[model samples]
Target chain A: MFDLSTPQRQSKKVIALYAFKSLRGFIFFFVFAAFGMRGFLEGLAFTGLVLFVAATSLIGPVIQYLFFKFHIEQDEFILNKGWLFKEKKAVPLERIQSVNLEQNLLQRILKVYSVQIETAGSKEKELEIKALDESAALSLKQALLDISNQREEQEKTEVTEPEKKTVNPTSNEVSSTLLKLSFLDLFKVGMTQNHLRSGGVAIGLVVGSYFKFQDVIKQFFGDYLDGWEWENLMSFASLGMLFSFLLIFLVFSIVVSLITVFSNYYGFKAVVYQSHLELSMGLIKRQEIRVPIEKIQSLEFRTNPLRQWLGYSTAYIYQAQSDANKASKVSIPACKKEHIKILQETAFKDSVVDATIDIPCNGFSYMRLASYIMLATLIPTLVPLAYFGDYNWVVPMLIPAVVIVFWSYMYGSNSGIVTDKGFIGFKKGWLFKSFSISPVFKAQAVEKWDSIFIRRREEMHVKFHTASGSNGLRYFKKDAVNHLLNYINNTVIKSNRNWM
Target chain B: MTNEQILTHSLPDIESFSFEKHPKRFLNKKLIANTLYMIPLAIAVGFLFYNFSEFPWLGWSGLGLWAFILLFSLFVNYKEYFVRGYTLREHDITYRKGWIFHHQITVPFNRIQHTEINHGPIDRLFNLCELEIYTAGGSSSDLSISGLDPKDAQNLKSFVAGKTSTHV
Candidate 1:
């Protein structure tokens, strides 16, 4: 059992890590300056400057390691920190959303883990315990969970009339392994991870970086390009050159994407216990997270055209948490489409796959989408073309105009669906499709808004605000908005169930 | 899926629901407060005009834009006072506001994390208060209804507080 009253300090190895991290910037600056001014300065002065920065950075974390202390009380976790300023903070146990345990390379070598406690509050407020022994962090987490459960049980007993003779059970013996991904499964996911989009991103990055440092690079290659002018750079853009460039980019994007995916999701495992779900994964940096089932706000099943063709879907579990760490989204990526159906049904405690009542948005939504595209892209394109009186720009502008029209037509055909059971789902996007399903009872609020355009066309935008975030249908028929709002509000008023 | 429907209640007519409007004096208070901000802005523009007399078009355009903003805001404030209203139900609260872009937000009692009553300096002058209802969603409150009578705001706050305690 973990004691609450005794304050504890993190592993002493954290001091060295903190010192090295803090001194990195100063070290880089000194090294760069010493090399740049090697002709002017003596070698002794450079070595002395390096020594001074290293010694200065070492002082702060050493003092901090001696002063930082933490302990847990009955319902709150208290942290006393700051070597010079002396600051104390107390976080209530009930407010904690999730406690994450992570281990990086340094932590693995030291045989310790870092703990991050996230609360359902503002983004600025998060508690971190760096470099705790693995066993100690686990025990501390178990103790905090136990205390939270006890408080919840006490609250429940008080709310209900007369306590039962039999004490309520705390833990269960049966634990089911919900899902596990193998190396082969990971390979498939990497192959289908939108390599085309990654290619676009890589091309953009290379172009941007070259332009940003063009002056430095040009000076380095002083006389290498004796007759190569700036205008001649694009003038050499033949069809053969473009094809070879694309081939190289394609290979680069696929290699990078596969490496990134495999490294991040090497050993993923998901298990379902009595009341919570546990997920552990990562290759170089490992993390373990626990989420209470009741805290889930919505389940989003998403897939792009490429992934759909490969017969895989990604499911995201949005829990009631502060949006500080967007990377904390619990996801089971590249699962079979059939597996998604089974998982969705099991999580929602209802049947959702067989529903055949998807209603598409108003047909006029196409006009709205097209106008938006024109205003965002074409209107700005015309500004410079008109100013420079460039007739050549008109042909280039026609290509994007045609592409925009096609994109709008596909996107505007999006739909919003509500089952007879009051489960709401929204289908959005064209190339990168995303589908979100939210239980009506979990919705915190419902909003209906009408702009002048929507009102004139008798359409409205209906938004379902959840604890994690919000999802909505854009420019649907007015009557459908009323029906959906009433259906959702009725579910909340009558269910008498907890939202979180 | 079960054959039984999840929606039990007969749909209420949203348009037919009676809404409680703010006091007419609230409009005057808003207009005064908004126009008062223009005094400093006008003073700064005047200083710029005196110092840079060479750029007559710049000074005149800045002053003209300021005057236009002052009059436009007065009209918008007056119109908003009429359009903004709220309705309290047994299990939920609905706030309807906006003119060009109309919005109606309905939040249930169980979703409300807390409630607060605020009396700003200008609002206190007119003996009015604002009731802000917060949910666990984020930094901003879910609903904020301003220009309410102090006693009414107090009563509503307590009512919401009571419901939140019972539901949560």
Candidate 2:
């Protein structure tokens, strides 16, 4: 057992990990030294700079590792670090949301794990132990969890009856493996991954790097680039070239998607304890995340047409919003329909299973489509009139107008709302569909909005705000909106359960 | 109650609540604040008019547009003052605002993370305070009730704090 009550530093190997991290920051300096410097004097200066970088990178991590110490005392987890400006943090045990373990390539090579202690507070306020052996990390996680549970029980007893102390039952808590992805399942997930998003990311990376490396390219081949004829090169480009280029991009994106899928979900597994769910995955940068069931504000399931046909979807578990990390939501990729059902049932025990979309916002859809079409038409018509002073450009703009109308129609038709006694769900999207479900009691606020036009049409928009985020129905009948608002409000007021 | 009963039960209608308007002096405060902004804008327009004296039509149109905007804003502020009202219920508080686009938000006391009473320089001069209620749902879901009497703000803050503690 790990003695967590006494202050301790991470494993000695953490110094090397820290050095590597700090050295990564000096990459720009290395690049500049390699390409920007010339002459013996400049070369000597570059050598000095390199020596300075090496010394600082080596010495900084040593100091950081030496100064860092953490221990649990009373009901607080205290951490002390920083060399020049001494810093200390003490987070109450009850406020800790989860204790995750992650192992990147470097850490894996060093045979050490990093522990991330997440609190219900802002992300910056959380704690991280850069390197700890597997057993040490596991024991520390358990110690923190056990103490937090004890603190909660103590608080409950104090609140209910000062004399009646409850015994901790964490030792006998049931743990079950919820889901595990097989090799074939992983392959299917990779094959059905969103290629479009991968393609967009790949293109973005290429464009961004091109701009980043533009100065370096100009320095090396400035004369050659200046003498080149860009107009002549464009004259040689044809429809066939464009088609071939598109095909290449498509193939590249699919490869990237497959690689990402294999690396991220290689050994995906989910395990659920009585109070929290744990997910561990990744081949290169292994990560394990744990979230208390109570803190989960909403659950979202997303799938494309292909994934839906393949009988799997990605589920996102949204907890209380941490100000520092907006993308703190945990996602489980390649969850079959049954898996999603199990997750939903686990997160919200009282929620109805397989609740269909009961309220369709068709009026809202029609209104959105109509307004989009009007805006599209108006923009094309007015822009050409203002710039060209003619209707000639409007002919070519008709193609985009038709595309917009079709997209808007599809989006509108696919959007809907699901309302049950204990749950509220919002479903939307055309090609990439997403459905999010949250308990009614989890709502922090309810908002009703009505523009003059919407009011004239006797329709309104209703939003349900949860701790994680907000979801709502748009362009619903006034009466329905009002009923939902009232229903949610009443449920929230009457329910004794905590939102988080 | 059964789930069916909970669904069918007639709860107090939020629409029927008789919302209370802010103090009449608060309207004067809003007008003064608007004037402070309008004065600088008017001066900028005047500077432009002087600089562009060669085009008499341009200066005249600029001045006309400024006048129209000034009048429009003043009218909107007045209308919005009436439309903006808040209703405190047994379990929740509702605030409605806007003239053209009506927005009403209801935050249950139990869901409130914390309550703060803010008294700015202008608010101090008017003996008014702004009661801000925050939730874990982030800033967008927070509620700020401005132009509240200082004593009333304190009472509401304490009441909300008490409610949040007990409910949780």
Candidate 3:
């Protein structure tokens, strides 16, 4: 066991980790100075400047490693850092949400691991220990979790029976493996990723980097490249060459998608403990994530057409989050139906399995489809009319118009709600289907929106807000919406279970 | 559970609650703030009219548009004051605002993370304050109720704080 009461520094290997981090930051500056200022500085002077900068950067990490210290004091976790401007932070033990361990290639080679401590809310600054041996990291995590569990039990005892303080058995150390992916499953996961989205992102990155490179060239050789137009250069390419270029770009994007999927999800495994779940994965940068079962607000299962055909869906576990941008979500890829069933059972017990009543959005769905059609065709119809000043241009645009109408109709018809006594679920999307389920007791707020038109038509939109996110149902009958809202409100008010 | 338990008729309905309107002095404060904002734009148009003799139509039209906007906004503010209301129930508080696109949100006291009372210079002049209630459900779900008496805001804050503690 590691002593956590006294202030302790990270493993000595952290010095090397900090030096490499600083070197990565300075690499770009060094390259730019070497090439951009070659005509202005002598070779000897340039070498001396580089040596001095490198030496100073290395020394900064040593000082940082020497000053950083952390320890557990009373019921708070305290961290002290900085040599000149000392900073101190103390987070209450009960406020800690999760402790994760991560190991990158460098840390693995050095036989060390980095630990990340996240508190309950996004407002709390996350704490990270640069390097720790395996035993030290595990002991630190165990100590923090034990203190948090003890405080929770104390609170419960105070509320129920103050005279008797019972000590429970240490069953938290016992865990069972829930799911593990084989090499074949990993390959299937890589193959079934959303290729179109990855391709769009790759294209965006290429375009962005091209523009940045152009700016750099203009800065360095502005006088040599005056009066040069990119349009003239692009006009020289033939149609055949353009087609082949597109083919190459498609191949490149597919390869990038495959690489990303394989590296991030290799050797994935999930284990269930008494009150939490642990997930470990990755090829080069391994991550171990712990999510407390009670903190989970919602569970989402999503799949595309190809994945659905292959009997695979991705599961996303959303926990209580104070900021939407920093939402804590753990995604498990290539989960079959059986795996999803087990996960759902763990998160929500039998509530989801008992959800049988289905409430489909039907009567007012036509109005939503009409609005979608109008919005989608507005730009396409206007651009042709404005450019040509003829009704004939709209003839060619009718093909795309029909496709949009069909897609909107499918979208409206596919969306619906499902509910039971203890859980409420929302199902949406036609091509990219998703089903999200949350316990009725986790609802934080309820919202009802009505427009003048919808109000006159006796229809409304309802949203159920949770700590993770919200689920919305649009164009529903007023009476049904009122019933659902009342049921949710009653459940939230009566249930004494903790929301987070 | 039986079907009778699922019947929602016996449950408390949010639509049936009676909402209370803001104090009348809050309307006066809104009008004063609106006029203060218009004064600077009015002076700028006047300055343009005096400096540019050749473009008299430009200055006159600018002044006309400015006056129209100011009058329109004052009318909207007055009408909107009547439409906005709030209600505090045993377990939750509901705030409803907006006229054309109406929306109502209800947040339970048990879910609130913290509360704050804000008193701006103009609000102080009117002896009013605003109460903000935050939850772990992000900024959009947080509630901000403006135009309240200082004592009432403090009482409301303490009541919510007490309720939250019991839940914890």
Candidate 4:
């Protein structure tokens, strides 16, 4: 009963979105053109140019949208577009990894959303319908998933038991909201944030811009500065001025973090459907992301010192499909502690503690790390100290060395753990700690490396590679690496779990 | 149960696993490739030595270091032929290589995204090819076992493909 020949176009709302995006891209050009214009003829020419550019941009999307059409074939989903180029691409339904629906404020207002189709065969989004009616988008996703599921069932040679519940693609079942961040939660996340890091970033930005500002000043007041003796400027570099500058920078960073957190995470909510987890956040854009439960690779529970003290931890669910343009690993930031446990339960569906094998960090490891750090810094500092012929330089060098040593000691003392039952679990982090749990069945590859340096200490570095990404523990005892590698490999070989 | 017995049954030792050595002629192929690469590098070093001949010891030491490195690499290449091997189990494959800094990589068939057979002009002359198995995460193959007879590589590829098709 399914007709495979007909092609369809996206909703007309995409035209406005595309035109708006194109107009936004011209802001820099407009600024530069306005700055360069001085005469009446030039202003007239600029106005004409703006009109011409706007017309061209507007016409492009209209023509492309008219030509763009997608069809659902028997075995593949085919998309054809581009009036001049006439491009056609067909993606096998079996290769389709995920279908994600996203909506911005404009899209929501227009009653349309974008559908991004990701395939495992390529890193990029294989297909994107820029705008579709909300119900249409959901139906498209459901149809694609159902087709894939049908193909999978057909490929299974063995006769298995029938599914307990048949999922209706067009069901009107509503999902329960798991967690939503209130204004107070956002405040906590902002307060418990790393103030020093953002402060350092602000300081770096100022320092970098200082040279450009100096160039501008030289252009304007070069002769004046040359004639004046500028020795007095060094007086402002005193310790008290430095401390106040740092305090101001810290305050500035705190303010920036609060503003950023509030704006980005405004109305943040996580919801659980039958087969997917939807995360909606952002104030201006109102970003919505759908992460399929099956595509999730690992669950990471992260807690910094302040968050630990505040009794809350951030959670991240790393998935297999990377976002179309931004290759960033998406994380659920500032999740409540109870929410973290619920997320783990939903993802793993089993007990967590029983599968853990904790590797205790001992004093010897700390001593080893300290010695390595000292030896690493000693050679670089010696030459500068000797050339300066002053012992004061050595003190400055030792400051960084001591801080590094202390950090190393802290990191070394923190225990590492790995466990495997239904899923593979690993825990790490000293100051900013995290526990990563990935399904054991999805273990793609396991590797062990024993470099000459590690070989001397009778240790090996082991890495566990999953579909999403790889994470590992370094400087473990050689036997431990061997054991971990064997366990993962054996499990992968013997288990009947379907990673796809 | 004794600890030894428990260890023997529970843990699959890397040393105990039987690994198939690559064809011996692969060493000749490696030497030719090395010589082709070293000729230009040696010429560049010689030109540098000629330009800075005023410091004769510098040139001599530079040449000595280059010669030492060339010889050491050749020896290591030869040694790797014996040590570098791959093993195919029921559902997974393992490739081991390197002498000083040893490494072993094991990849399950279900995790393999795809497999590729690659060969160069020299490799064709030697009737050898490389089998590269790629995973989902990255651009690079998870395991690339070079220096295989074309037929053998094809067989392995098909075997892996069959396993992956069934499992994935």
TM-score of chain A of 1: 0.87
Sort by DockQ, top down from the best: 2, 3, 4, 1
Error of 1 at B19 (Å): 1.6
Worst ten-residue run, lDDT, model 3 chain A?
A: A350-359
**TM-score, one value per model:** 0.85, 0.90, 0.89, 0.85
Candidate 3 structure quality by residue, lDDT tens digits, A150-231: 7887886777555646456277778888889898887787777877778889889888987867757777788878866788
Candidate 3 deviant stretches above 4 angstroms: A43-48, A157-169, A211-230, A233-246, A324-327, A351-357, A362-398, B1-17, B32-75
The CA lDDT at A153 in model 4 is 53
Q: Estimate the lDDT of model 2.
A: 0.82
Compared with the true structure, all predictions reach lDDT values of 0.77, 0.82, 0.82, 0.74
Error of 2 at A409 (Å): 3.8
Query: Residue A54 in model 3: shift from native, Å?
Result: 1.8
Candidate 3: residue A240 Cα off by (Å): 5.0
Query: Cα lDDT for residue B162, model 3?
Result: 93
Task: List DockQ, one per candidate, in order.
Answer: 0.37, 0.49, 0.48, 0.42
lDDT for each residue of candidate 4 in A340-428, tens digit (9 for 90 to 100): 76787776665364344555444356657687878777878777778888787777777777777777667756746567456667777
Candidate 1, residues A1-500, lDDT tens digits: the string is: 44557898887888877887787767657655755676777778877877887787898788888888889876788999997699898888887777889888778777889888877655665788888887788987877776776666566566653354245545534577777889888888888788888777877989999886565566677588667887887998899999998899788989877877777787988777765778888888888888877677788877887787877778898887655656446888876766667566556766465454366775458756776867688778788998899878887887877777777767767556655466787777776777778788888888888875667677888888888788877777777777778778768777666677
Task: Tell me the tens digit of each residue's lDDT in model 2 across B1-168.
Answer: 222222121443433346778888788898888878788778877887899888878777878888898888888888888878887777788898887788899998888888899999999999998999998845768899999888888888898888788777
For DockQ, the strongest prediction is 2
Cα misplacement distance, residue A400 of candidate 1 (Å): 3.1
Residue A306 in model 4: shift from native, Å?
0.8
Fraction of true inter-chain Cα contacts (below 8 Å) kept per model?
0.53, 0.68, 0.68, 0.56
Which 10 consecutive residues of model 2 chain A have the lowest summed lDDT?
A: A163-172
